[model samples]
Target: MVLNVAVVGAGVVGLSTAVALQQRVKNVKVTLIADRFDEGTTSWGAGGLFRPDLDSYPAEHQSSFRQWISDSWKFYNALASSEHSQDCGLTFVAGTLLQNSPKDLGYSCISELTHDFQKLDEAQIKKMNLPSTFKYAYSCTTVITHVPTYLRWLMQKFRGNGGKVECRKVSRLSQLSDDFDLVINCCGLSAVELCQDKSMYPVMGHLVRVKAPWFKKFVFSDDLYIIPHNDYVLLGGIKDAGNWSRAPDPAKRNIILSRAYAMFPALKHAPILDEWVGLRPGREKVRLEVELIKGGNKKTIPVIHNYGHGGHGISLSWGCALHATRLVQELTSGLQARL
Candidate 1:
């Protein structure tokens, strides 16, 4: 008999989990349930950079966070080498971290740590024609994701593997428990209402996707960044914590564009393709755990949560999905052994 698994949410985390589970777990039926799909997800507008900000995880799960990130880097790195790299929305771009302080997580993590990461000095800054007072910089090779293409490819792969994606907005956990024996919740911000998690809130992000085929390098300036990819150059953004508004505010848009242009003046010439607004499914930290919830008539269902990715969903999706699959395996194996 095959184990039936339902993955809640259709964002990067959810879709990635479905793909990984189908590949790893044998004799399993996977159903991906979500109210919104494809472009409706916050992952659509992400810059998809690889370095993980340590804050992407809850404090209690810090160790696990490090492990997940390490595993994810390896996982995606292998995928990038494959012929399916484009389908996976993975590409290698030389990364530059420019900030005045040592507090920048990317600088700290990638610079002098990973492959070809080096700190830039005043001479190098001048050579790059960077801003004055930009007292710190680091250059390294890193991967960036094209979320739209990647999500579509992932969904296709999921369905091709005998998985089902149901388009529905779940009002209660009972609805899921009624159908599937196990549910993996990747509902992101919706998890706030679904799980009644008070710690979850929206970290708003505004991005401008412009056609900048001429631009290939990635630039990071404070919270604002200008990352160029194949389809469009991603200009981002602000981390407005506790903000629930999804509408793109003109003032915020100006701020984002201005900051990005200040870093790369040439971006002013790129035709504006679109402006995107998304609420990062932020929690005190990302939730990647399991729970047994009792529904009507004393029926218990296992739920594995993999949401609260904040702005790092694209960067951490593969890792989080891998972890969720492990939890699913544990759940199913325990039941099989009658443990």
Candidate 2:
């Protein structure tokens, strides 16, 4: 018997979950449904850096959060080493993360997961000539995904595996019960309304793409960052919690460009390619669990929530997808045993 699975949302997280379910679960039909795709989604505007802050997760789940981070690093690291790396928009890049004080550099979690993690010495700091306010610096090699390119690649891969795509908006969980045996909610920020999750909000981000091929490394200090993608460089941004405006603010754009240019003088002359704004699905803790919802006539529909990733959606995509897939398998097997 074929299990009809509906994975909502077409962003990186949703696509990743859909692909994983199709590959791991036998005799299952996976269909990806979303109201937005590609550039319309927030995942497309991200710098796609594989850096996760331990503080993002709740204190109770620190160990599980660490596992997620490590699993994500290993998954992307292996992908970057594979022959399909370029096609999948995966690449290894060396970058520096700076802070005003040594105590503020709470990246020990990331350091443990990545390679060549080291504290920057005075010589290295002086060579970079960062502003006087930045005293602490660390360098590490990390993976980055070119969002647009990577999303396109995922769409192709998912379709190639006989996954179906449907363009539709889901307002409630019960709406899917009649057609699908199970539903995976990866609606991201829209989960606020769909799931009636009061804890969920938007963390607005703005970024500017510039034609700066000569810039080869990533530089990040606080909210300001310069990431060199395969084709262009991405400079960003602001993290205004509870802000839902998708329009690019002129004031914020100026601040981003000014800060980035101050850090790297060459960007001052680089031609601006495009500007974008996205709303990250922010919550106190990422929701990745199973819920059995009863529809009309007491029909039980198993739903797996895999959203609330916020800005780390790309970084945590694979790990979260793997976990969600496992939950799905467990749910299916339990039902099979009952039969």
Candidate 3:
């Protein structure tokens, strides 16, 4: 008998996990169950930059962070170069990150993986034509994810591989235990309710997508960023924790537009294509381990908890998914669950 596996989210992390399960696992029926999908998920509105927020992992797992990011880069980098890139919304973007004061640019894993990475000099910074407050900068070439396209591509890939999708909200883990032999919880912010994970928090992000075909390169300073896609440019945002509102705030829009206009005057005349507010699921540390929990039938069921990815969900997705796949492999070793 094949093991039934369920992944409980549709964001990048969830879809990535489901896809990895199909590609790497055996004798399993994978079903991606989520309340929302594609453009409705938070990952869709992300700037889609590949910078990994390394601190999101625990101290013990910190060493593995590099490998995770490296593996993820390899995954996206391949797609960005493939013929399906435009169809999948995968783009190789090079951009500058600036700050007013000198700070530790210690994400060596990202720097090491970038196709081109460097610190900008006075001339380089001058060429950017930024306000004088920005004194330090660096440039790097990395993959940016257009999650809407990527997620749809993943869904199609999953279905092609004989996977299924259930568009229903799982209020709790036990509810799924009856149908699935093992459940991989990639619930993201919903974990706060489903798993009673009090540590889960939401980092509200506000973004404005403008019609800027000329804005090919991205520029980021703190939470404020301008990232480009195939058709439009994304200007954002605020990173206010514990803010759960999804409606776009006019005040937040002004803050984003005003700063963007000052940084790139050309966009001042660019028509606003859209605005969005999405929550980045945040936790003190990412949780990626297995637990034997009480099931709906009172017998134990295997649960691989893989959520709490914060802003780096896309950056660390494949790495975390592969690792989660390994956990599923171990859980079903020799079909022990069948016995």
Which candidate has the highest TM-score of all?
2
Question: Residue by residue across 1-339, what tens digits does model 1's lDDT show?
Answer: 678888888888989999999999878899988888878778877778876666444567766666667777787778777898998788888967777775455344444335788877778878887654678877888878787888998999999999987898888776676777888888888877998988898988888888989898887766788788887888886889988898988898899888877767888998999888888887766788888888775768888888887767787788889988888887887765542
Reference-based lDDT, each prediction: 0.80, 0.87, 0.84
lDDT of 3 by residue, 107-170 (tens): 5677778868888888888987776468888888878888888888988889999999999988
Which candidate leads the pack in lDDT?
Answer: 2
Candidate 2, superposed: residue stretches over 4 Å from native: 103-105, 337-339
Which is better, 1 or 2, measured by lDDT?
2
Model 2 over residues 1-339: C-alpha lDDT tens digits?
A: 678899999999999999888888988899999999998888988999887877667779777677777878888889899998999999999998887767322587788878798898788889987654587888999888998888998899899999999998887888788888899999999988999989899998999999999999988878698899977999996899999899999999999999987777778999999899989999887899889988765668889999999878898888898899888888887655543
lDDT of 1 at 313: 79
Arrange candidates by lDDT, descending: 2, 3, 1
Q: Is candidate 1 or candidate 3 better by lDDT?
A: 3
